[model samples]
Target: MKTILNALAEPNRLQIVELLRDGPLTVGDITDKLRMNQPQVSKHLRVLNQSGVVEVQPIANRRYYKLRPEPFKELDTWVDSYKHLWNERFDRLEDYLHKVKRKEVDDE
Candidate 1:
């Protein structure tokens, strides 16, 4: 997970991942969409591959990159843990607001 986070921390790498989210893309396709030079794109792709954030498939002569499910699943699970806490806090705040509204109406 640390490796995944580190790889995604780069602006270029994050854009690459966003491009891949639509579907698998060749390095050329990514380069065209991002308007980045081939070598720079390739370097980011290599780091993403090493971090297990993206997987490469060689189809004929072209290499296609796509997101790996496991790392993203782990990330989702980690985020869900925090999601529950935030939901609880929001729920409590809503309740307090409702009570205040009721108190205002009672005073009127």
Candidate 2:
């Protein structure tokens, strides 16, 4: 979890993960989409791979990158557990706004 979280902390790495959500991409494809140099892209990929958030597959000399998925699911589960806190706060705010509006309408 820490590894995945740390990997995702980097903005470029997050974009790379989002890109890999669709399908595997070669280094060239990633570089083109990100408009970054090969070395920089490769460095991001290395961190992602080390964290197990992404995997690399080589066909001939071209290597393709894909998201591992499980790490994201784990992160999602962790986030899901705390989501009700947001839901509760939003519900309270909504109720308050409704009452305030109703009071204003009645006064008017």
Please report how far candidate 1 places residue 65 from its true position, in Å: 1.3
Go through the candidates in order and give the C-alpha RMSD of each one to the true structure.
1.7, 1.9
lDDT of 1 by residue, 37-64 (tens): 9999999999999999999999999999
Q: What is the lDDT of candidate 1?
A: 0.96
**Clash number by candidate, in order:** 0, 0
Candidate 2, RMSD to the unseen true structure: 1.9
Candidate 2 lDDT over 1-108, as tens digits, reads: 898899999999999988888899998999999999999999999999999999999999999999987898899999999899999999999999999999999999
The true-versus-predicted C-alpha distance at residue 3 of model 2, in Å, is 2.8
Query: Which one is best on lDDT?
Result: 1
TM-score of candidate 1 against the unseen true structure = 0.85
**Residue clash pairs of candidate 2:** none
Which candidate achieves the best TM-score against the true structure? 1
